[model samples]
Target: MTRRVEFQLIEKEITRIDSLVSRGETELSWKSDGVLEYMVELGELVEGLWRRIKSAQMNVGKIKAALDAWTRTPLIARKDRRKDALLSFDERPEKVSRRYGEVERAAEQIHSLLEENKLLFQVGDGMEEPWQRYVAYVDGIVMESLRRAVGCSLGEWMLDVFCYDYC
Candidate 1:
């Protein structure tokens, strides 16, 4: 089974075990044998959960490393061209389109990775509110970056249009 499925199963088992223990403590005799067995099973399940958490953490670290690498690589390489040289009209649109495509693809990949491995990001009490907020924050940043890229591209296009028409 996938790690996600395994985690779900383990979580269900832990919840069940907790209810059983609570019932046993409140309703059953102190010397009941069933309580001892449930305690042992609970211990085993806890250990399994711990191991899975560690594995998930490692996977999250690797994903973060990949994201870091992607961020470090420039979407458009500006080193080869002269700083003061303006791109020709024919080249400008193509370069802007290509850069926008690259940014979109990178953003999609980041979103997918986060979506597929969401369980890895959960901390402490496994509340969904925090996770939702984190996702929203990431999405907001991605959208803002895309907005800036498009704005800059439009600005350049406007400048080129004016230069061609009036300069």
Candidate 2:
């Protein structure tokens, strides 16, 4: 999911698709099949989000459990002197998890959008030359938005656990 790797995926797959098109080796049926495969991946992500949404009520407990795990992390070493500074909540329990309520709301918004757009995306992806269709253009835009939201959510979760330095 790193920036460097994303387009490699697009490049590898899209090149094959574009090649088939250029060689006039692809028929309408193949285009439809490719679109279906793409939608299926998108659908799985949406489904995972839906399941997470359904389990939102337990997230606080999960977060707490994960936070507790930090103390037991082997990375913290037996002779580690950095322990106090690392675990100190004295500076305040960081801003990332502090805003969990809003984050949950935002996640819910994405879940709602997925529910509303699920069928639309399927239909849109199935359209003629959908890879070049106008509706497909919008789907790409929405996919970007979804990627942003997903990145934000996971980033915040990582920050909350001090898995990486906070911004």
Candidate 3:
């Protein structure tokens, strides 16, 4: 999928996971058979979102590498001129620089999301019970992921919450 489409899918899944967590928080019965099934579905959704996050990270890495390679390569080689001569011959350096900037921005966003939620992703890894694990995972990860997916920085999110409560 295109990068835009992949990002859209990730955002959609984040919303869906958030909705599930909201329902699970207030409505789900911990001891009901239906709750077990709900937890199972949530687990599947989280796993899928994790996979997509990894894939997007990898793609960003690849694009950055390609941009790096392009920047290093000389469009023309002239032995008669100084080393700086090759810099002048570089093709559309501005375009490459803009593309590189875009890639770097994307990489930074993805990196920040992963870094912020690193522990949350592993919340229930060692748990022995599926329902308990899923509950923990949803409570720990979904809200944070939703915040990031919605393009809110931590400070911004906190401000919004503060405003909602006190303003």
Candidate 4:
């Protein structure tokens, strides 16, 4: 889950930073280059995150698929939100939470990583993380994509890795 979230952010950041770079014409200033260099670093991380997410996703999918062959997808006993149900019934919410946490941790890491490179920007060096402002935007896109892509749906595939003991 965390891997998925990080993967999504990494992709979006690469696109966003690249676009900013393309539109930028700042006279080789340190912040500009810091942005550029960090963007490059971000791109590398994003690609790495994507590969890992895809692998984890497929692995989870495979695990689910295998379980699906015999395991019945559990349905909610009463009408309730999926997340609520998943938290209450899904035995492996830890996996999702752990996955989600990984992305969160990465954002923290990248924030500092981006700043260290931002020294190249040669401006606003001390207290604030210069790159902090961009984190929310990129993180939002990542979460939104995953929510849009995989969440808000009911399907047989959902039941494999996450078995509903309550249902």
Candidate 5:
């Protein structure tokens, strides 16, 4: 279905942007001006894609309804319409089912990547510091905002405080 094609296009664009971000990370210093600009540009692109995905999800829902209607309708229509309905019945179901999952995975990946970018700003926590593997910077404005919002300093929150095995 057309929604599947559109979804694939969005997926490709997200992947492209991610690749660019990854390349920049490898090629440029994290504290360099170029890296900051790249991070902002990447953030903007991800936000735009997020908005598009929200709207696209609605469009996909509409297309799914059309597919449902075609499948449920009587087969007494004109030849072309009947042919289309039949073709859609065969192809649309799988695309309709898979597109949602694909979009959801994309959204989750984007969120994770964005969180990683944000995490780069946090430092001196000393708790394994997985974020260290990504980038380095001292001015954690984003982390400060989060700290203000949460009313606590995450850097001081020792990993041992959490009982989860993953932590």
Candidate 6:
């Protein structure tokens, strides 16, 4: 559903933010001491959150696909491309139930993070719903990170140009 899609999009945004942060840190590390140091802890936290969101996305995707497959072929054999295994009619419920448990746990982890960090995330108009707010907040974060990265790159290029002209 929408929650699963939001989770996947948020996961992708998290990955993008991490990449931007890593690049920024690497660039600053060569000529800095404390600037990048502070990011280390923040980066770890983001990584931890990303891992949870990723786990949730994977589990949800798997469960959704399995359920859809079962719905389509309620009493027939089907080739489960995700697991690369043949699933008989009798095996659908058991597998779906098992995956549903995993999905619940992962989803709870994500929801917990959202609840704890509600202030850090933006909740604007049309984002009255939890999932909508989450998607908007993560997308906003991704955009902000990209803007910062671009600004940093520009500053670095200007510095190089000035050094070349003077020296």
Highest lDDT: which candidate? 1
Decreasing lDDT order of the candidates: 1, 3, 6, 4, 5, 2
lDDT of 2 by residue, 3-81 (tens): 2222222343446545645544444454565666655655665565445434432442343343333222322121233
TM-score per prediction, in order, is 0.40, 0.23, 0.41, 0.27, 0.33, 0.32
lDDT of 4 by residue, 1-167 (tens): 44433334344445765665565544445555466775676578557645655654454344333323222322322235354444334434754565456546644654554443334222243424433543454445445544543432344336533566544
The number of clashing residue pairs in model 3 is 0
Model 1: per-residue Cα lDDT at residue 63: 46
Residue 159 lDDT (model 5) = 27
> Candidate 6 lDDT, tens digit per residue, 1-167?
23544544345456766776786767666467666665776677677665655655564444344334323322323345322233344676876576567446644654555554443333344445755655565445445544554565455445545655674
Per-residue accuracy of model 5 over 1-167 as CA lDDT, tens digit each:
22343333355565879798788867877666677778888888877777665554454344333334323332222235532222223544665556455445544644454354333322234523433332222123234433442332221132223423343
Q: Model 5: how far is 26 from its true place, Å? A: 0.5
For residues 1-167, what per-residue lDDT tens digits would candidate 1 score against the true structure? 33443344346556866887687678777577677776777678666667666665555555455345434433343335433334345555676686567656676777666665465534345546555665665565566655665565565556556655776
Q: Which regions of candidate 5 fall more than 4 Å away from where they truly are?
A: 1-4, 63-167
lDDT, candidates in the order shown: 0.57, 0.42, 0.51, 0.45, 0.45, 0.51
lDDT of 5 at 93: 62
Q: What is candidate 1's CA lDDT for residue 72?
A: 43
Sort by TM-score, top down from the best: 3, 1, 5, 6, 4, 2
Write model 3 residue lDDT over 32-93, tens digit each, in one string. Answer: 56998899999999886777567545644543443344333333323343432222334457
Which TM-score value belongs to model 1?
Answer: 0.40
Separate clash counts for every candidate: 0, 0, 0, 6, 0, 0
Model 5 residue 104 CA deviation (Å) reads 32
lDDT of 1 at 148: 60
Superposition-based RMSD of candidate 3 using all C-alpha atoms, in angstroms:
19.1
